[model samples]
Target: MNKFVYWVPAFIWIAVIYYSSSTPYEKQDIKPWLGDWVNLSWAGPYLERISFTYNNQEVSVAAQGIAGFIEFFIRKGAHIGVFFVLAFLIYFALFYTVQQNKNKPLLAASAWAGTVLYAVFDEWHQGLTPNRTPYAGDVLLDAFGGGLAVFVILSVHRKNGRKKKFNIE
Candidate 1:
């Protein structure tokens, strides 16, 4: 029962991810709210200078306008931040549920692998949702988020001198 408790947070987070992915992109757009809250005219020149092709579409303030330009980054940042927390929750669950004496490196790797797999699943789900386009780059971003969380956890353990517990080999 206690082991099941350890897994609850990860499961809940997975559900939350699924719910978010199921929402149509039109419903999730926050550009109107952003436009109402602040003046972005001053940012136009700087944002306009930044432009790139993503998934065969041009992404720029000139193309999307100031509010949309800001929203674009917010959405991308959410992908990284959400996956980072998910990775940590998964690592915590694994730490308590896995057999004793396994090194922390193995646990962290497992958590990261789980995170990347979920990221792939999430993009696939988004592909099925209305107005949502799954980009491979977003999956890479999610993996980077998971990797970052593992790096921080390993660093903390190393700094605390838990050499035997955190050993890679």
Candidate 2:
């Protein structure tokens, strides 16, 4: 694969994150499609069962305003998920670009560092948008997601050993 090809998806995903953050709260909240998906009758009871403690009170999804609560999780999940993909792609791109004898651990660390920096930039970008206040907590969440991606990649790479090739076909 061309080295540049690996970067395309990562850049595009980052663009998506930026676009999502740029939307005003009201415009982004409870997107009709998501609202429909989460409200399916078959999943209603399970969704209601999901809850978390905030301010010393247990808040169920329904109690929190069903659509709003679900939207919060969806947005946070997107943060985690997009960063995960970004880190993974960065690692693979670096792996291919660097010399074969270069230390793999360093490449993994670099990928994570890049992901962290991107998360910070992402938060800053959000701060520039009206009705959006960047939170440090979201950066931490992004780091956790990137870290998980690096851990999974390193673990599998280690398990397979250096000599083995992963044949997708």
lDDT of each: 0.92, 0.80
- Stretch of 10 with least lDDT, candidate 2: 160-169
Across residues 31-90, which tens digit of lDDT does each residue of candidate 2 receive? Answer: 566667655555557788788864354556677556666667778787788889889988
Pick out the ten consecutive residues of candidate 1 with the lowest summed lDDT. 160-169
**Candidate 1 structure, TM-score to reference:** 0.92
Give the number of the best model, judged by TM-score.
Answer: 1
- Provide the lDDT at 65 for model 2: 57
* Residue 117 lDDT, candidate 2, scale 0-100: 98
Cα RMSD of all models vs. native, in order, equals 3.5, 4.0
